[model samples]
Target: MKAWRLGWARGVVELRQSFSNGGDLVSHFLWPVLMLVALFFLRDREFAGTGILLGTLALPSILGMNAAMGMVSMSQQLTADREDGTLLRAKATPYGVQAYLVGKVVSVAGGLIADLVILFVPAMFLVDGLVFTPLSLLSLLGVLLLGLVATLPIGAILGSAFPSARAQGLVQLPVLAMIAISGIFYPLTALPGWVQVVAQFSPIYWLGLGTRSALLPDATVVVEAGESWRSVETVLVLGAWAVVGLLIAPVLLRRMARRESGSSVAVRREKALQRVG
Candidate 1:
């Protein structure tokens, strides 16, 4: 209980720092601004036969992609902390690893939510055809919440498995590929049938589908798989991933922490300095 409280406090402090730090603030806003600009250009363009503005469809999909990218941020931050000896220091303290993990989850999730708001508010005016009824709002919230739970723990496992910050780059290529196949900027129906089959297995696809379901009008359903939102399938797939990730993450994180030591941190730091030099 005490550790949980301590973790929560630590997360709050870090979240505050993320907003206060000039570079971090710039980073937090940069992608959303780029996305908005892209949305601007796409706003007038219409999807073939669908009679929907590309931007209107894209806006919600981008939101989902951004939410899933939280996983990458989590992995990168973990690697950075490991290289800087933060993980080692935490290991030396009593129940510090538990506190540190809790703090990371809180800060990462909080930051993702802030970024979503930054994207969503300006997005409402720039794009039209969005339906934001009370039910839609609730659906959006549910999808976002589920998306985070599905991705974050898996991210923790990735972070723990990678031995160095540079190795984290390997995680990004697959994520980008997943985003492309997941229909963030475009509809999946336009893609090859096999690709759609592969994408359905990924969380990114479900997140995008869920977000699109929440924001786009019911008429737009004709373009989706089964010509419906498949809300049940979305929940089932994401829930399964969440369950798997939650079960595996703790074991992986504990194993990773058990191996952390001052020597390993020093080795990583030396490698990082060499890269910089």
Candidate 2:
């Protein structure tokens, strides 16, 4: 209980810093602006006989994609902390590792919510056909929560696996590929059957599908496979990933924590300085 309280406070502090820090502030706004630009271009485009504007379909999916990206941010933050010895310092304190993990999750989730609002509020005016009821709000909230649970653990695992920020760059390609095929900016129905099947396995797809289910009208189901939202599959697949990741992350995090030391941080800093030089 004490650790959780401390972690929550730490997270709040970091979240505040992200909003105030110049570089972080730019990052917080830049991507959302880019996405809004994309939304603007797509706002009027027809979805090829679907009687739906592509923007209407894409807006919610983009929200979902943004939510799932908490994973990437989590991975990157963890890697940065490890390199900078934040994780090591936390390890020195009682229940500090636990606090650190909780702090990261809170900070990442908070940032995601901010990014969503930055995009969603402006997007509400830019897109149409969205349903906004109390039920839909609750549904969107549920998907966001479940999506975080499913993805954050995987992020922790990835963070633990990589030794440095440069190595962490390797994760970006696959994530970008996943976003492309997972139908963030496009409809999955346009893709081949095999591609659709493959996309279903990803949490990104489920996040998008879930968000669309909440925000889109019933008629939009035509664009989805089986002409349905597959709510059960969304919960099950995301839950499965959550379960597996929960099982594996602690062990890996603990192992990684064990391996960190003053020497390792110095070595990484030295190499980083050499590269800069």
Candidate 3:
């Protein structure tokens, strides 16, 4: 209980810093702005005679993509903290590992939600034909929450697996490829059947599908695979990932944290300085 309280406070402090820190603040806005720009170009274009504007299709899909991208943020933050010895410092404190983990989840989830609102509020003005019913709002909330549960633990595992920022950079390519195949900015129906089958396994794809189901009208289902939302499958796939990731992430994180030492941190710091030089 005390750990949760302290962790929540720490998370709130870090979340506030992210908004106030110049570089972090800029990053918080930049991606959403870029996404909005993309929506601007797509707002008027129609998707394959579905009569729904492409931007209408993309806005919610992009929201899902952003939600799933929390995984990347979690991974990157973990890598950065580990490199700088934050994990070691936390390990020395009482109940700190649990606290640190909680804080990361809170901060990352809060930041991701804020970013979504930033894009979504402005996007509502730019895009048309979106459904804004109470049920859809509930559905959106549920999907986003489930999507985070499904992805963030895997991200922690990735961060633990990669000891350095440079190694973490390699992770982005595969994630980007997943996003591409998951149909974030386009319809999944347009992709090859094999690709669609592959995408079905990705949490990102389920997130996208879930959001599109929530925000789009029933008629707009024409663009989905099999012209259906597959809500049950979305829930199942995301739930399964959430379960497996939760089970594995804690063990991996603890192992990684155990490997941290003062000497190791100093070596990494030296290497980082050398690289900078």
> Residues 1-277, candidate 1, lDDT per residue (tens digit)?
9789989998999999999989999988999999999999999998895688899999999999999998899999998898899988998898799999999999999999999999999999999999989999999999999999999998998898888888988999999999999988889998999999999999999999999999999898887877989999999999999999999999998898899888888888898899999
Q: What lDDT score belongs to each candidate, Candidate 1 first?
A: 0.93, 0.92, 0.93
Superposed by TM-score, candidate 3 places the C-alpha of residue 38 at a distance from the truth, in angstroms, of: 0.4
Per-residue error at 100 for model 1, in Å? 0.3
- All predictions: root-mean-square deviation over Cα? 0.9, 0.9, 0.8
Q: Tell me which residue pairs clash in candidate 1.
A: none
List ranges where model 2 is wrong by over 4 Å.
none
lDDT of 1: 0.93
**Residue-wise C-alpha lDDT for candidate 3, range 175-270, written one tens digit per residue:** 999999998899988999999999888899989999999999999888999888999999999999999999999999989989999999999999
- Stretches of model 1 off by over 4 angstroms after superposition: none
Residue 277, candidate 1: C-alpha displacement in angstroms: 2.3
Q: Write the per-residue lDDT of candidate 2 for residues 10-52, one digit (tens) a residue.
A: 9999999999989999999999999999999999998887679
TM-score of each: 0.98, 0.98, 0.98
lDDT order, best first, reads 3, 1, 2
